[model samples]
Target: MRRVLIIGGGVAGCATALALHRAGFAPVVFEGHPDSGEDIGAFLTLAANGMAALRELDAAIAVGRAGFPLHTLEFAGGVRELAGHRCLRRAELCRVLQAEVARRGIPLHHGKRLASAAEDADGITARFTDSGIARGDVLIGADGLNSRVRALVSPGAKPRYAGQQVFYGYSRPRRPPCEPGRIVMVRGEAAFGFAVSPGGETYWFARVSTVESPEPSWRESLLALLDKDCAAIVAATRGPVLGTNARDLAQIPRWRTDRMLLIGDAAHAASPATGQGASMALEDAVVLAKAMRDTANPLEVYEQLRRPRVEYNTEASGRMSARLPPMDVPPPVSEEELAGQLDWSRRVELTAAE
Candidate 1:
């Protein structure tokens, strides 16, 4: 069996571990964080494609327990019913996935930040900041945007600002503007979105175009940019607002070496405007595990299958961040083709073009 060393125990790392274990590989996770509450203040939504990937790993039900389902999207355009989506706290999702990994007796070590890695013909050894080491047949970097492994794989591949600042917060409005299971998008001077939970809490996020970093009173500045209802929601926030610069890796010329590979945000991170970061990571886990199970050159095959789709998302998201109109770019793959690619029972296959 191939022993896979996985770095970063966030969404990508945990999901990769579960998928690899199910495919009969020995995969161990090494996380830099001392605990699982790394991004406790942030929240995200898993679209239908992401939910489908979890289902392929048989983990949808376990993860479904933490988040509530979202069924409708309301915007300047008419409302539309969604296929299958879930909204939840980022830390809560990590907790659920990590708990599932533990339930299956997988090895997960925390606070062991990756320092460096050396690869040989036979295997690769990962050295951690804690002076710990592990030898594995291959290394998979499932780290986040500021990934250390990415530096080793492709030097000078840094994250570029996607031209926006993202802010997140929760509010308890006595009278919620929208019903539960519905996400309302407000497109004013800035792009804003909010979803009300069954318990009457409102989860909202805003993306504002800006080159400079936000000030200490970003909340007040953001309020000034929003309309009356949106401003009211921000004013009624339950706690301090959380904000961050939107960043992404527009392109990475190299994704792997002889015995090392990059996956998830470490490989292809898109801006939050798309809201496809976690979903894309989940899809990577499933496709990569299948490749490892059925290919002689798993790394090469994995990149061929994933690069086109992820790059398309990166480009589209960047355009949205810049407040540009939608381009007529063709999708990398059709929904039917993607379904076939993610299907676990079927053997992995790629078209001639891919």
Candidate 2:
């Protein structure tokens, strides 16, 4: 039996472990957090491809709990339907993955922040801040966007900020909520806001175009900017803010050195503009697992099989990103506009950028 050590137990890490186990290989997972049950305050969409991968891990039934069908998505003039869509809470999604992993008797080590790693021809060894170490015939870094493992693998793979920033909020329905049958996206100049469902929890992400400002510390500077653009969604929130810098990286030419390889965000990060980050990462995990299972030289197989997918997705995300407008314009600009934003009788229509 072959042993694998995987770093980062978020969506990508847990999925990879489960997939590997089903492929007759069990992988030990290391999560930087103190526990495997904390909520990340974000929801992810499991597209067709992603859903297929989870089913392969025997996790679809559980995944159903973590996610509702994201069947409909709409884009329009800054305020899409306030309701109607299949959604789930981010917490629910993680819980589902973690539960499946536990049921399989997979070992998961939390609070084990990766400190350093060295890969030899035979295997790879990883040192953690928790004063522990793990070694395996193969090492995979599923650590998220800011992947420490990636740094060690390809030092030159710097993340280029995707000139967009998103402010996310979690909330419950107030009175009659936005229509509940679709993922709603409101588009405007250099900004767009969306409402999504995860674990039955309502989630919103507001993106502001950073190209106009060109500032590295734009998050601080653009506080007012986001607030203005995402007025409708902001007003509807009933929970704490789940925020982070929106950024992405394509790939590292030398993703593998000996028995180690990088996967998911560590290898490539697509912009969230197209909302495909989670879906693509899911594909990366399963694709890599399949490649490894089919070949003796897992590294070579994983590299060749996943590179094209990563590159294609990366380019698609960038192209979609370039079409977004720069931040600066405010929404309806008043509570009255919010009230009169959409008429129930009139049909609202949206067209993607040409």
Candidate 3:
């Protein structure tokens, strides 16, 4: 049996473990986080392509049951509505995915961060920060944007700041009941997006061009920056703001070595504007596992087919980020242009390895 060692226990690592397990490969997942049930993050929308990839890996049904789907996504406060969108609590999605991984009996080691990896003719060996080691026939790097595996493969590669910062939070208002089935986005001094999930909880995010992350009062800061209409949405919210710096890895020249492969953000990281990061990771997991099952040189096949697709999205994300107008200004891209980007993102589908 060919044992596979996977890094990062997030969406990509867990999905890869599940796919590889189904493909008759023994896979062990290593995560830097210490808990198997650690789910802390902002909300995310798993567009159609992301949903399709999860269906391919048999992970979507479970996720759908746990998370709600989006029937319509309204941009610039209903200026445009994109059909077929879904929103999920980031923590909930991780919890569900990890549960699926556990149900499949895949070995997942939390707190096992990858420090370095060494490859030879026989196989590859991964060294963890805790001094633990793991050996496998091949290693899959799903460790995300700042992947150590990626550094080992291409030392020159790094993520570039996308010139945007985001804050996320959940709100429940008694005066104005939360409405479900629509995601409303408002563009003004900054970008404010909010959607009511099927569960009636409001998930909102505020995007600004601040290079330096705001203080703990992120929500208040965002509230102050937003226009009165958008500010009302955040002002009615109640919770701590989850802040994240947006980054883009334009493209990577190398995605694999003879005995190692990089998948998910490690290989190509797109900006949040695309809403395809999770989808791409899910797609990579399924495709790579299928490739491994069918081909002797799985790494080569994975890279050849996956790189171009990821690079295209990365480029598109960069362009979209660059086009975002300044505070209190109109969006650089028109509704038609934004619709085109949405179309491209929603149309992404996974293909089985040849």
- TM-score of predicted structure 1: 0.97
In order, the Cα lDDT scores of the candidates are 0.90, 0.66, 0.76
Error of 3 at 31 (Å): 0.9
Q: For candidate 1, write residues 1-354 as lDDT tens digits.
A: 289999999999999999999999999999999998267778999999999999998899988888999999998988899978999998888898899889998999999899999999899999999999999999999988999999999999999988888999999876897899999998988899999999999999999888847552467689999999999888889987788998999789899999889999999999999899999999999999999998877888899999989999998999999988886978988899899889999888653245
lDDT (tens digit, per residue) of candidate 2 on 1-354: 289898888888998898788777979999998876446666666665566566666776778755566555666534333221235555676777877888999998888889999877777788988779888887888887778888888887877767666566665544323444466665554354455454344566666665533323423443455445355445657756655556788666678777667888788888777666666666667666665565556666666655766666666676667663444333222424212211222221211120
- Report how far residue 3 has shifted in candidate 2, in Å: 0.8
Top candidate (lDDT): 1
Candidate 1 C-alpha error for residue 81, in Å: 0.7
Error (Å) of candidate 2 at residue 221 is: 9.6
- Please give each candidate's TM-score: 0.97, 0.79, 0.86
Reference-based TM-score, model 2? 0.79
Which regions of candidate 1 deviate over 4 angstroms?
A: 214-217, 351-354
**Candidate achieving higher lDDT, 2 or 3:** 3
